[model samples]
Target: MIAQTLSQLRQLKLTGMASALQTQQEQPGPYEGLSFAERLQLLVDQENQERQQRKQERLIRTAQFKLKAHAQGIDYQHPRGLQQSQMAALLQCDWIRKAQNLLLTGPCGSGKTYLACALGHQACLKEYSVRYVRLSRLILALTQAKADGSYGKLLKNLASFDLLIIDDWGLEPLKAATRNDLMEIMDDRHDQSATAILSQLPTDQWYQSIGDNTLADAILDRLMHNAHRINLKGESMRKKLNSLTQAEHLG
Candidate 1:
Protein backbone atom coordinates (compact mmCIF):
# COMPACT_ATOMS: atom_id res chain seq x y z
CA MET A 1 0.00 0.00 0.00
CA ILE A 2 2.81 2.42 0.87
CA ALA A 3 4.54 1.69 -2.46
CA GLN A 4 1.31 2.18 -4.36
CA THR A 5 0.67 5.51 -2.60
CA LEU A 6 4.19 6.70 -3.37
CA SER A 7 3.80 5.69 -7.02
CA GLN A 8 0.50 7.56 -7.25
CA LEU A 9 2.11 10.68 -5.76
CA ARG A 10 4.94 10.49 -8.27
CA GLN A 11 2.48 10.10 -11.14
CA LEU A 12 0.59 13.11 -9.86
CA LYS A 13 3.86 15.16 -9.78
CA LEU A 14 3.48 15.82 -6.03
CA THR A 15 7.13 15.19 -5.28
CA GLY A 16 7.12 17.32 -2.15
CA MET A 17 4.21 15.40 -0.69
CA ALA A 18 5.83 12.10 -1.70
CA SER A 19 9.09 13.08 -0.02
CA ALA A 20 7.27 14.12 3.14
CA LEU A 21 5.34 10.84 3.17
CA GLN A 22 8.56 8.89 2.78
CA THR A 23 10.11 10.75 5.72
CA GLN A 24 7.06 10.20 7.86
CA GLN A 25 7.10 6.51 7.07
CA GLU A 26 10.82 6.23 7.82
CA GLN A 27 10.39 8.05 11.13
CA PRO A 28 7.00 6.54 11.95
CA GLY A 29 7.33 7.04 15.71
CA PRO A 30 6.83 10.80 15.44
CA TYR A 31 3.95 10.68 12.94
CA GLU A 32 2.20 7.66 14.50
CA GLY A 33 0.21 9.77 16.94
CA LEU A 34 -0.96 12.27 14.34
CA SER A 35 -4.51 11.92 12.98
CA PHE A 36 -5.08 11.20 9.30
CA ALA A 37 -6.33 14.79 8.71
CA GLU A 38 -3.22 16.20 10.36
CA ARG A 39 -0.98 14.01 8.22
CA LEU A 40 -2.73 15.14 5.03
CA GLN A 41 -2.41 18.79 6.10
CA LEU A 42 1.31 18.34 6.67
CA LEU A 43 1.73 16.92 3.19
CA VAL A 44 -0.19 19.80 1.67
CA ASP A 45 1.88 22.33 3.58
CA GLN A 46 5.11 20.74 2.44
CA GLU A 47 3.99 20.74 -1.18
CA ASN A 48 2.95 24.42 -1.01
CA GLN A 49 6.26 25.41 0.62
CA GLU A 50 8.27 23.55 -2.01
CA ARG A 51 6.32 25.17 -4.81
CA GLN A 52 6.89 28.65 -3.34
CA GLN A 53 10.62 27.99 -2.99
CA ARG A 54 10.82 26.82 -6.59
CA LYS A 55 9.01 29.96 -7.76
CA GLN A 56 11.39 32.19 -5.84
CA GLU A 57 14.38 30.38 -7.33
CA ARG A 58 13.02 30.88 -10.84
CA LEU A 59 12.47 34.58 -10.17
CA ILE A 60 15.99 35.05 -8.83
CA ARG A 61 17.51 33.19 -11.75
CA THR A 62 15.69 35.45 -14.19
CA ALA A 63 16.73 38.65 -12.36
CA GLN A 64 20.48 38.32 -13.17
CA PHE A 65 21.63 40.91 -10.62
CA LYS A 66 25.34 41.80 -10.60
CA LEU A 67 25.34 41.79 -6.79
CA LYS A 68 23.73 39.03 -4.80
CA ALA A 69 22.25 41.57 -2.42
CA HIS A 70 19.28 41.14 -0.11
CA ALA A 71 17.21 43.59 1.93
CA GLN A 72 18.08 41.84 5.21
CA GLY A 73 21.80 41.93 4.38
CA ILE A 74 21.94 45.72 3.88
CA ASP A 75 24.48 47.44 6.09
CA TYR A 76 22.62 49.96 8.17
CA GLN A 77 25.85 50.57 10.03
CA HIS A 78 27.38 52.18 6.97
CA PRO A 79 26.94 55.98 6.86
CA ARG A 80 25.79 55.98 3.25
CA GLY A 81 22.73 58.24 3.79
CA LEU A 82 20.46 55.17 3.71
CA GLN A 83 17.55 55.24 6.13
CA GLN A 84 16.50 51.93 7.59
CA SER A 85 12.89 52.99 7.76
CA GLN A 86 12.81 54.10 4.12
CA MET A 87 14.45 50.89 3.01
CA ALA A 88 12.03 48.87 5.08
CA ALA A 89 9.08 50.56 3.41
CA LEU A 90 10.54 49.97 -0.02
CA LEU A 91 11.09 46.33 0.81
CA GLN A 92 7.33 45.82 0.79
CA CYS A 93 7.53 46.42 -2.97
CA ASP A 94 4.36 48.51 -3.15
CA TRP A 95 6.09 51.03 -5.38
CA ILE A 96 6.72 48.39 -8.00
CA ARG A 97 3.09 47.36 -7.97
CA LYS A 98 2.13 50.97 -8.50
CA ALA A 99 4.48 51.21 -11.49
CA GLN A 100 6.52 53.99 -9.92
CA ASN A 101 10.19 54.64 -10.52
CA LEU A 102 13.23 54.79 -8.20
CA LEU A 103 16.17 57.12 -8.84
CA LEU A 104 19.34 56.43 -6.85
CA THR A 105 21.96 59.15 -7.19
CA GLY A 106 25.35 59.31 -5.55
CA PRO A 107 29.07 59.39 -6.18
CA CYS A 108 30.91 56.25 -7.25
CA GLY A 109 31.15 53.61 -4.52
CA SER A 110 28.38 55.22 -2.51
CA GLY A 111 26.41 51.92 -2.66
CA LYS A 112 23.88 52.95 -5.28
CA THR A 113 24.35 49.76 -7.24
CA TYR A 114 24.15 47.63 -4.10
CA LEU A 115 20.97 49.29 -2.94
CA ALA A 116 19.41 48.91 -6.38
CA CYS A 117 20.32 45.25 -6.42
CA ALA A 118 18.91 44.84 -2.93
CA LEU A 119 15.57 46.25 -4.05
CA GLY A 120 15.65 44.04 -7.10
CA HIS A 121 16.28 41.09 -4.82
CA GLN A 122 13.30 42.00 -2.69
CA ALA A 123 11.13 42.27 -5.78
CA CYS A 124 12.15 38.80 -6.80
CA LEU A 125 11.32 37.48 -3.34
CA LYS A 126 7.84 38.89 -3.87
CA GLU A 127 7.70 36.89 -7.14
CA TYR A 128 8.07 39.88 -9.40
CA SER A 129 10.16 39.53 -12.59
CA VAL A 130 13.25 41.76 -12.65
CA ARG A 131 16.14 42.60 -14.93
CA TYR A 132 19.36 44.48 -14.18
CA VAL A 133 21.46 46.03 -16.92
CA ARG A 134 24.21 48.61 -17.07
CA LEU A 135 22.92 51.69 -18.91
CA SER A 136 25.93 52.02 -21.26
CA ARG A 137 25.89 48.34 -22.09
CA LEU A 138 22.11 48.37 -22.65
CA ILE A 139 22.46 51.30 -25.03
CA LEU A 140 25.19 49.54 -26.96
CA ALA A 141 23.13 46.37 -27.19
CA LEU A 142 20.11 48.28 -28.39
CA THR A 143 22.26 49.99 -31.00
CA GLN A 144 23.49 46.65 -32.23
CA ALA A 145 19.94 45.27 -32.22
CA LYS A 146 18.89 48.22 -34.33
CA ALA A 147 21.56 47.34 -36.87
CA ASP A 148 20.28 43.76 -36.93
CA GLY A 149 16.61 44.88 -37.25
CA SER A 150 15.73 43.28 -33.89
CA TYR A 151 15.39 46.54 -31.98
CA GLY A 152 11.62 46.29 -31.57
CA LYS A 153 11.83 42.71 -30.33
CA LEU A 154 14.56 43.68 -27.87
CA LEU A 155 12.49 46.56 -26.53
CA LYS A 156 9.48 44.23 -26.19
CA ASN A 157 11.52 41.78 -24.16
CA LEU A 158 12.79 44.52 -21.87
CA ALA A 159 9.28 45.85 -21.38
CA SER A 160 8.07 42.50 -20.09
CA PHE A 161 10.09 42.68 -16.87
CA ASP A 162 8.16 43.88 -13.80
CA LEU A 163 11.14 45.82 -12.45
CA LEU A 164 14.03 47.06 -14.59
CA ILE A 165 17.25 48.25 -12.95
CA ILE A 166 19.47 50.45 -15.08
CA ASP A 167 22.77 50.74 -13.26
CA ASP A 168 25.60 53.23 -13.94
CA TRP A 169 23.37 55.84 -15.47
CA GLY A 170 25.18 58.89 -16.88
CA LEU A 171 28.55 57.15 -16.97
CA GLU A 172 28.91 58.41 -20.53
CA PRO A 173 27.35 61.15 -22.59
CA LEU A 174 24.29 60.04 -24.51
CA LYS A 175 24.40 60.40 -28.29
CA ALA A 176 21.34 61.46 -30.31
CA ALA A 177 20.51 57.89 -31.30
CA THR A 178 20.92 56.56 -27.76
CA ARG A 179 18.84 59.37 -26.32
CA ASN A 180 15.98 58.52 -28.65
CA ASP A 181 16.33 54.87 -27.80
CA LEU A 182 16.16 55.69 -24.11
CA MET A 183 13.11 57.82 -24.65
CA GLU A 184 11.36 54.96 -26.42
CA ILE A 185 12.12 52.62 -23.53
CA MET A 186 10.81 55.11 -21.02
CA ASP A 187 7.72 55.64 -23.08
CA ASP A 188 7.00 51.93 -23.10
CA ARG A 189 7.50 51.67 -19.34
CA HIS A 190 5.74 54.87 -18.33
CA ASP A 191 2.88 54.09 -16.00
CA GLN A 192 3.27 50.42 -16.96
CA SER A 193 6.35 48.99 -15.22
CA ALA A 194 8.74 50.11 -12.52
CA THR A 195 12.29 51.24 -13.32
CA ALA A 196 15.22 51.92 -11.03
CA ILE A 197 18.08 54.14 -12.20
CA LEU A 198 21.45 54.15 -10.39
CA SER A 199 23.60 57.11 -11.25
CA GLN A 200 26.69 58.96 -10.09
CA LEU A 201 25.46 62.23 -11.57
CA PRO A 202 22.98 64.55 -9.92
CA THR A 203 19.52 64.92 -11.45
CA ASP A 204 20.21 68.49 -12.55
CA GLN A 205 23.14 67.47 -14.75
CA TRP A 206 21.20 64.70 -16.45
CA TYR A 207 19.60 67.09 -18.88
CA GLN A 208 22.96 68.28 -20.14
CA SER A 209 24.38 64.78 -20.20
CA ILE A 210 21.60 63.64 -22.50
CA GLY A 211 22.96 66.08 -25.18
CA ASP A 212 19.72 66.63 -27.05
CA ASN A 213 17.48 69.06 -25.17
CA THR A 214 14.26 67.97 -26.88
CA LEU A 215 14.74 64.23 -26.42
CA ALA A 216 16.06 64.77 -22.90
CA ASP A 217 12.86 66.55 -21.97
CA ALA A 218 10.75 63.72 -23.37
CA ILE A 219 12.73 61.05 -21.55
CA LEU A 220 13.07 62.87 -18.25
CA ASP A 221 9.38 63.73 -18.28
CA ARG A 222 8.51 60.04 -18.25
CA LEU A 223 11.23 58.94 -15.81
CA MET A 224 11.48 61.79 -13.28
CA HIS A 225 7.91 62.94 -13.04
CA ASN A 226 6.75 59.87 -11.14
CA ALA A 227 10.01 58.85 -9.51
CA HIS A 228 11.19 58.63 -5.92
CA ARG A 229 14.69 60.05 -5.54
CA ILE A 230 17.29 58.75 -3.12
CA ASN A 231 20.44 60.85 -3.01
CA LEU A 232 23.17 58.91 -1.20
CA LYS A 233 26.04 60.80 0.46
CA GLY A 234 29.20 59.70 2.30
CA GLU A 235 32.70 58.39 1.71
CA SER A 236 33.33 55.62 -0.79
CA MET A 237 32.53 52.15 0.56
CA ARG A 238 35.29 50.65 -1.64
CA LYS A 239 37.90 52.91 0.00
CA LYS A 240 36.62 51.99 3.44
CA LEU A 241 36.80 48.25 2.62
CA ASN A 242 40.38 48.69 1.30
CA SER A 243 41.38 50.50 4.49
CA LEU A 244 39.90 47.70 6.61
CA THR A 245 41.81 45.09 4.59
CA GLN A 246 45.07 47.00 5.06
CA ALA A 247 44.47 47.29 8.79
CA GLU A 248 43.81 43.58 9.08
CA HIS A 249 46.99 42.76 7.16
CA LEU A 250 49.04 45.01 9.44
CA GLY A 251 47.59 43.41 12.53
Candidate 2:
Protein backbone atom coordinates (compact mmCIF):
# COMPACT_ATOMS: atom_id res chain seq x y z
CA MET A 1 0.00 0.00 0.00
CA ILE A 2 2.86 2.38 0.77
CA ALA A 3 4.52 1.65 -2.60
CA GLN A 4 1.19 2.18 -4.40
CA THR A 5 0.66 5.50 -2.63
CA LEU A 6 4.17 6.67 -3.57
CA SER A 7 3.59 5.67 -7.21
CA GLN A 8 0.30 7.57 -7.27
CA LEU A 9 1.96 10.67 -5.83
CA ARG A 10 4.71 10.51 -8.43
CA GLN A 11 2.18 10.12 -11.23
CA LEU A 12 0.34 13.13 -9.91
CA LYS A 13 3.57 15.16 -9.93
CA LEU A 14 3.38 15.76 -6.19
CA THR A 15 7.12 15.48 -5.75
CA GLY A 16 7.25 17.45 -2.47
CA MET A 17 4.50 15.39 -0.90
CA ALA A 18 6.06 12.17 -2.16
CA SER A 19 9.45 13.04 -0.74
CA ALA A 20 7.95 13.94 2.61
CA LEU A 21 5.97 10.70 2.67
CA GLN A 22 9.06 8.65 1.85
CA THR A 23 11.01 10.28 4.67
CA GLN A 24 8.12 9.79 7.05
CA GLN A 25 7.95 6.09 6.26
CA GLU A 26 11.70 5.38 6.22
CA GLN A 27 12.55 7.45 9.29
CA PRO A 28 9.27 7.10 11.07
CA GLY A 29 10.28 7.83 14.69
CA PRO A 30 8.72 11.28 14.92
CA TYR A 31 6.22 11.00 12.09
CA GLU A 32 4.91 7.66 13.31
CA GLY A 33 4.00 9.22 16.62
CA LEU A 34 1.87 11.85 14.98
CA SER A 35 -1.86 11.31 14.41
CA PHE A 36 -3.04 10.72 10.81
CA ALA A 37 -4.39 14.27 10.57
CA GLU A 38 -1.05 15.74 11.68
CA ARG A 39 0.86 13.56 9.20
CA LEU A 40 -1.39 14.66 6.37
CA GLN A 41 -0.94 18.30 7.38
CA LEU A 42 2.82 17.84 7.30
CA LEU A 43 2.71 16.53 3.74
CA VAL A 44 0.50 19.43 2.65
CA ASP A 45 2.85 21.90 4.27
CA GLN A 46 5.82 20.40 2.43
CA GLU A 47 4.04 20.72 -0.93
CA ASN A 48 3.04 24.32 -0.20
CA GLN A 49 6.59 25.19 0.82
CA GLU A 50 8.00 23.69 -2.36
CA ARG A 51 5.54 25.64 -4.49
CA GLN A 52 6.40 28.90 -2.75
CA GLN A 53 10.12 28.28 -3.26
CA ARG A 54 9.60 27.62 -6.96
CA LYS A 55 7.56 30.79 -7.38
CA GLN A 56 10.22 32.92 -5.68
CA GLU A 57 12.92 31.34 -7.82
CA ARG A 58 11.00 32.22 -10.96
CA LEU A 59 10.56 35.81 -9.82
CA ILE A 60 14.28 36.25 -9.11
CA ARG A 61 15.31 34.61 -12.36
CA THR A 62 13.14 36.95 -14.40
CA ALA A 63 14.22 40.11 -12.54
CA GLN A 64 17.71 40.19 -14.16
CA PHE A 65 19.30 42.45 -11.53
CA LYS A 66 22.92 43.42 -12.24
CA LEU A 67 23.76 42.84 -8.58
CA LYS A 68 22.40 40.24 -6.21
CA ALA A 69 21.61 42.72 -3.44
CA HIS A 70 19.19 42.14 -0.61
CA ALA A 71 17.75 44.43 2.04
CA GLN A 72 19.31 42.40 4.85
CA GLY A 73 22.77 42.92 3.37
CA ILE A 74 22.56 46.73 3.15
CA ASP A 75 25.38 48.57 5.01
CA TYR A 76 23.69 50.87 7.46
CA GLN A 77 27.04 51.54 9.15
CA HIS A 78 28.36 53.35 6.09
CA PRO A 79 28.25 57.16 6.31
CA ARG A 80 25.98 57.18 3.27
CA GLY A 81 22.77 59.05 4.12
CA LEU A 82 20.75 55.85 4.03
CA GLN A 83 18.38 55.67 6.99
CA GLN A 84 17.45 52.34 8.51
CA SER A 85 13.93 53.45 9.33
CA GLN A 86 13.30 54.63 5.77
CA MET A 87 14.66 51.42 4.31
CA ALA A 88 12.64 49.38 6.76
CA ALA A 89 9.46 51.10 5.63
CA LEU A 90 10.34 50.71 1.95
CA LEU A 91 11.11 47.04 2.48
CA GLN A 92 7.41 46.48 3.04
CA CYS A 93 7.02 47.37 -0.69
CA ASP A 94 4.05 49.62 -0.11
CA TRP A 95 5.50 52.21 -2.47
CA ILE A 96 5.43 49.76 -5.33
CA ARG A 97 1.93 48.76 -4.40
CA LYS A 98 0.93 52.41 -4.45
CA ALA A 99 2.52 52.96 -7.88
CA GLN A 100 4.92 55.63 -6.60
CA ASN A 101 8.44 56.22 -7.88
CA LEU A 102 11.82 56.24 -6.11
CA LEU A 103 14.83 58.36 -7.02
CA LEU A 104 18.29 57.35 -5.77
CA THR A 105 20.85 60.07 -6.36
CA GLY A 106 24.51 59.93 -5.40
CA PRO A 107 28.02 60.34 -6.67
CA CYS A 108 29.89 57.47 -8.31
CA GLY A 109 30.22 54.35 -6.10
CA SER A 110 28.01 55.75 -3.37
CA GLY A 111 25.93 52.53 -3.55
CA LYS A 112 23.10 53.98 -5.63
CA THR A 113 22.93 50.99 -7.92
CA TYR A 114 23.21 48.58 -5.00
CA LEU A 115 20.34 50.24 -3.12
CA ALA A 116 18.12 50.37 -6.20
CA CYS A 117 18.81 46.73 -6.95
CA ALA A 118 18.12 45.82 -3.34
CA LEU A 119 14.69 47.44 -3.53
CA GLY A 120 14.02 45.61 -6.79
CA HIS A 121 15.03 42.33 -5.14
CA GLN A 122 12.62 43.04 -2.32
CA ALA A 123 9.86 43.73 -4.84
CA CYS A 124 10.50 40.39 -6.50
CA LEU A 125 10.32 38.64 -3.11
CA LYS A 126 6.92 40.23 -2.66
CA GLU A 127 5.87 38.58 -5.96
CA TYR A 128 5.99 41.81 -7.98
CA SER A 129 7.46 41.48 -11.46
CA VAL A 130 10.65 43.54 -11.82
CA ARG A 131 13.23 44.44 -14.45
CA TYR A 132 16.61 46.20 -14.02
CA VAL A 133 18.42 47.98 -16.80
CA ARG A 134 20.87 50.83 -17.06
CA LEU A 135 19.25 53.90 -18.58
CA SER A 136 21.81 54.13 -21.38
CA ARG A 137 21.31 50.50 -22.27
CA LEU A 138 17.56 50.91 -22.14
CA ILE A 139 17.69 53.88 -24.50
CA LEU A 140 19.95 52.05 -26.90
CA ALA A 141 17.67 49.04 -26.89
CA LEU A 142 14.62 51.17 -27.44
CA THR A 143 16.30 52.87 -30.38
CA GLN A 144 16.99 49.50 -31.91
CA ALA A 145 13.46 48.43 -31.22
CA LYS A 146 12.29 51.48 -33.10
CA ALA A 147 14.43 50.54 -36.07
CA ASP A 148 12.98 47.04 -36.05
CA GLY A 149 9.38 48.23 -35.74
CA SER A 150 9.00 46.74 -32.26
CA TYR A 151 8.99 49.99 -30.31
CA GLY A 152 5.35 49.78 -29.32
CA LYS A 153 5.67 46.17 -28.31
CA LEU A 154 8.76 46.91 -26.24
CA LEU A 155 7.03 49.73 -24.40
CA LYS A 156 4.11 47.43 -23.58
CA ASN A 157 6.43 44.74 -22.27
CA LEU A 158 8.37 47.23 -20.13
CA ALA A 159 5.18 48.64 -18.72
CA SER A 160 4.01 45.22 -17.59
CA PHE A 161 6.59 44.97 -14.82
CA ASP A 162 5.35 46.03 -11.41
CA LEU A 163 8.73 47.53 -10.51
CA LEU A 164 11.28 48.89 -12.99
CA ILE A 165 14.78 49.69 -11.73
CA ILE A 166 16.57 52.07 -14.10
CA ASP A 167 20.21 52.34 -13.02
CA ASP A 168 22.85 54.77 -14.20
CA TRP A 169 20.43 57.48 -15.18
CA GLY A 170 21.84 60.64 -16.78
CA LEU A 171 25.03 58.86 -17.80
CA GLU A 172 24.74 60.49 -21.23
CA PRO A 173 22.83 63.29 -22.83
CA LEU A 174 19.57 62.18 -24.41
CA LYS A 175 18.82 62.69 -28.07
CA ALA A 176 15.43 64.08 -29.10
CA ALA A 177 14.17 60.68 -30.19
CA THR A 178 15.37 59.05 -27.00
CA ARG A 179 13.64 61.73 -24.97
CA ASN A 180 10.39 61.00 -26.76
CA ASP A 181 10.82 57.30 -26.20
CA LEU A 182 11.50 57.90 -22.51
CA MET A 183 8.39 60.01 -22.21
CA GLU A 184 6.33 57.22 -23.74
CA ILE A 185 7.77 54.63 -21.40
CA MET A 186 7.20 56.89 -18.40
CA ASP A 187 3.68 57.66 -19.51
CA ASP A 188 2.83 53.99 -19.74
CA ARG A 189 4.05 53.41 -16.20
CA HIS A 190 3.15 56.79 -14.72
CA ASP A 191 0.12 56.02 -12.65
CA GLN A 192 0.18 52.24 -13.00
CA SER A 193 3.66 50.93 -12.10
CA ALA A 194 6.54 52.08 -9.92
CA THR A 195 9.97 53.09 -11.29
CA ALA A 196 13.21 53.20 -9.29
CA ILE A 197 15.80 55.50 -10.85
CA LEU A 198 19.47 55.43 -9.84
CA SER A 199 21.38 58.49 -10.94
CA GLN A 200 24.73 60.07 -10.16
CA LEU A 201 23.37 63.55 -10.91
CA PRO A 202 21.22 65.60 -8.57
CA THR A 203 17.57 66.01 -9.56
CA ASP A 204 18.00 69.74 -10.12
CA GLN A 205 20.43 69.22 -12.99
CA TRP A 206 18.32 66.56 -14.65
CA TYR A 207 16.33 69.10 -16.70
CA GLN A 208 19.47 70.59 -18.24
CA SER A 209 20.85 67.12 -18.83
CA ILE A 210 17.69 66.16 -20.62
CA GLY A 211 18.24 69.30 -22.79
CA ASP A 212 14.70 69.83 -24.03
CA ASN A 213 12.69 71.98 -21.68
CA THR A 214 9.20 70.86 -22.81
CA LEU A 215 9.90 67.12 -22.84
CA ALA A 216 11.95 67.31 -19.66
CA ASP A 217 9.07 68.96 -17.88
CA ALA A 218 6.66 66.24 -18.98
CA ILE A 219 8.96 63.35 -18.07
CA LEU A 220 10.19 64.79 -14.77
CA ASP A 221 6.71 65.78 -13.70
CA ARG A 222 5.42 62.26 -14.20
CA LEU A 223 8.42 60.73 -12.47
CA MET A 224 8.81 63.12 -9.53
CA HIS A 225 5.25 64.02 -8.69
CA ASN A 226 4.70 61.03 -6.44
CA ALA A 227 8.29 60.03 -5.96
CA HIS A 228 10.38 59.40 -2.86
CA ARG A 229 13.98 60.59 -2.89
CA ILE A 230 17.16 59.16 -1.38
CA ASN A 231 20.28 61.23 -1.73
CA LEU A 232 23.31 59.11 -0.78
CA LYS A 233 26.10 61.35 0.55
CA GLY A 234 29.47 59.77 1.38
CA GLU A 235 32.81 58.70 -0.01
CA SER A 236 32.79 56.31 -2.90
CA MET A 237 32.25 52.77 -1.66
CA ARG A 238 34.50 51.42 -4.40
CA LYS A 239 37.42 53.55 -3.22
CA LYS A 240 36.85 52.41 0.34
CA LEU A 241 36.88 48.77 -0.69
CA ASN A 242 40.07 49.29 -2.71
CA SER A 243 41.73 50.97 0.26
CA LEU A 244 40.81 48.07 2.53
CA THR A 245 42.29 45.66 0.00
CA GLN A 246 45.51 47.67 -0.13
CA ALA A 247 45.74 47.69 3.69
CA GLU A 248 45.30 43.94 3.81
CA HIS A 249 48.05 43.47 1.23
CA LEU A 250 50.45 45.78 3.10
CA GLY A 251 49.79 44.00 6.40
- How high is the lDDT of residue 185 in model 2? 91
Per-candidate TM equals 0.93, 0.93
Please write out the lDDT profile of model 2 over residues 129-224, one tens digit for every residue.
Answer: 999998888988998998999988999999999999999889888999989988999999999999998899999999998999999999999999
Report the Cα lDDT for residue 222, model 1. 92
RMSD for each of the candidates: 1.8, 1.8
Following a full C-alpha superposition, what root-mean-square deviation does model 1 have from the true structure?
A: 1.8
- Model 2 residue 72 distance off true place after TM-score fit, in angstroms: 1.8
Per-candidate local distance difference test: 0.91, 0.91
Model 1 residue runs over 4 Å out of place are: 244-247
Lowest lDDT 10-residue stretch of candidate 2: 240-249
| TM-score (C-alpha, index-matched) for candidate 1 | 0.93
Q: What is the lDDT of residue 63 in candidate 1?
A: 86
